[model samples]
Target: MPTPSKISVVTERGQVSIPAQLRKELSLEKGQQLLWEKTGEHEIRVTVLPERKPRGAMAMLGFAKRFRQTRRTEDWMAELREGEK
Candidate 1:
């Protein structure tokens, strides 16, 4: 089934309000960033970029320290490969 389209009027300042239904459906939050691109002479596309989260080695620092390895690497690999036999 085709989804019905929603429309919004552009304001004098060129700002348009995203319809509440679409916003809720898309899970858009305040301060979310969107990318707008012109695909054709009269067509444009809007994409919602995934929310940015703090991610990097720094963010993962000390994460592995919380758990201790109980077995050697070789033992673990052998155990994993045993199922392949």
Candidate 2:
């Protein structure tokens, strides 16, 4: 497997610098398209794809179902509050 890229955040703005090695590996260029999504409270997912669509709808739906199935009502309330912030 290829090694994951090391990335750094920009201090002045809420931007991140993707490592050169990873860019080259992914064939990313200055104007290449990318998608950014907040995967968790402390982590953001950045993916380079021509179309900014999730890989599979079924997987996403299944994940949502599993999440709802696992969470308590209080947990759902806490998540809603977190999103408001």
Candidate 3:
């Protein structure tokens, strides 16, 4: 079965809303980016880019296995502070 076409109007600022049904089906979220490309004279392609994983603490999960720590937390902090003097 062919899916019915959806129509959207470009606003004065050139913004177009994606239909609710399609947004839900695609799992689109706010702040997500879309890639637009010109395919032909009258056609364009829009692709949903994969969401990027957050950096910092969340990105460091399970990273401890790669490097072993030999000193205690307090010892390490004290050593770092000693360098300031």
Could you tell me every candidate's TM-score relative to the true structure? 0.60, 0.50, 0.61
Best by TM-score: 3
- Which is the better candidate, 1 or 3, if ranked by lDDT? 3
Return model 1's CA RMSD, one decimal. Answer: 11.0
TM-score of 1: 0.60
Clashing pairs in 1: none
In angstroms, the error of model 1 at 48 is 0.5
Q: What are the per-residue Cα lDDT tens digits for candidate 1 across 5-42? A: 98889999999899898788889999999999999998
Q: Highest lDDT among the candidates is held by which one? A: 3
Decide which is better by lDDT, 2 or 3. Answer: 3
lDDT of 3 at 35: 98
Q: Supply the TM-score for candidate 3.
A: 0.61
Please give the distance, in angstroms, between residue 14's alpha carbon in candidate 2 and its true position after superposition.
2.2
Clashing pairs in 3: none
- Could you tell me the TM-score of candidate 2? 0.50
- lDDT tens per residue, model 2, 1-85: 9776575867787767878888777888777788889999898788886845557764475565655566688999999999999
Model 3 lDDT per residue over 12-74, tens place: 999999999888888999999999999999888899999999799999998887898788999
Scored by CA lDDT, what does every candidate get? 0.88, 0.77, 0.91
